[model samples]
Target chain A: NAGVTQTPKFRILKIGQSMTLQCAQDMNHNYMYWYRQDPGMGLKLIYYSVGAGITDKGEVPNGYNVSRSTTEDFPLRLELAAPSQTSVYFCASSYSGQFSYNEQFFGPGTRLTVL
Target chain B: AQTVTQSQPEMSVQEAETVTLSCTYDTSENNYYLFWYKQPPSRQMILVIRQEAYKQQNATENRFSVNFQKAAKSFSLKISDSQLGDTAMYFCAFMTRHTPLVFGKGTRLSVIA
Candidate 1:
């Protein structure tokens, strides 16, 4: 199965512009997450969904929004993009918190540059 | 709150040699999970190994193994006979039942031939 997939492997946005980073998982995972990794740094969570229709803010959720309308899709929206939002974004899925699950499979990631 | 720390920012090893990546975490939860993920140049996050806090024995996956020290809050990954393909950024992550998974800054490992 394509564990998880993210669209737009690369993107460049102007300040005040907006875009959506699409993510999907075919594994029917109950948990999906959005994370951003700046150059030479670890990833910080932006948002997450335990299940469809249940989304929550993560460590760094400013300037972004998310929705999990279906089990397979969790898309992140960037509004009024700023240079600070320049980073590599990742989408991951897992069977987390259910019956002792192990790992979270991730997508290749989307590299965003805001100018 | 839980925090994962990878002290070594970068490390290198000769081909066929062994290397260890150190990780430490802080958490009050007694039962939780720890994970090590490898991100190659392709930017794919690959799960290398994982450990459960309740388990006394460390977890091993083929050439990759973890030295889990629950008392010290340490979870180190040891790669045996490092190969060129093993070169990647390794991140240590922590998660408890109540909180979101937190990740360390990561240690860059270079396996040189």
Candidate 2:
């Protein structure tokens, strides 16, 4: 069903470069999120959107931006990629904010290396 | 801020044996949710199991089960009759309906023959 799809499975960017990680979900979920996974650190939330046009900052939001223009799409932007920004980025979606229905369906992560 | 911890960086077990992955979390909210997510080499995060704070009974899914201790703030995952395909990175996450999840460093499990 292509629950969640992320574009550019892998990318390499020079310092100061800009790029966008595209994420789309066909499930029409209300909650969408962006998280980055480092070597030993677990996935850290970057940004989240409850619905279209409503976005909020997460635990780690520096050097990144996000937009939820439609229920099916949530894209994360890297304005000035830095070496510290190198990590595997994942996009996820859930039915709602309720804990009972909180299981998130994640997309195939996008591995980005900032050099 | 809430935090989840997986003390074990890695663990190994023989096929058909049972293994337990330890996890502990810190949170002030009494109402929240805990989850175990499995990430294979492919890096896709899949939900293995979930538990609610109010529920005292453990949650079980197939060969996977959880030991949720509210007072101790501990949640451990137990896999019975583990198979070769069970090898993966397991992450413990905490979340409330009002906020996003706080994930642990993760424990890499290797099931060998």
The numbered model that scores best in DockQ is: 2
Residue pairs with colliding backbones in model 1 are none
lDDT of 2 by residue, A67-104 (tens): 98899999999999999999999999988654444689
- Residue A22, candidate 1: C-alpha displacement in angstroms: 0.4
Off by over 4 Å in 2: A98-101
Give DockQ for candidates 1 onward, in order: 0.61, 0.72
Candidate 1 lDDT for residue A65:
97
Q: Give residue A26's error in model 2 in angstroms.
A: 0.4
User: All candidates' lDDT scores?
Assistant: 0.93, 0.93
lDDT of 1 by residue, B15-80 (tens): 999999999999988999999999999999989888889999999999999999999999999999
Name the docking class for model 2: medium
Clashing pairs in 2: none
List of chain B TM-scores, one per candidate: 0.99, 0.98
lDDT of 1: 0.93
Model 2 chain A worst lDDT run, 10 consecutive residues: A94-103
List runs of model 1 lying over 4 Å from the truth.
A98-100
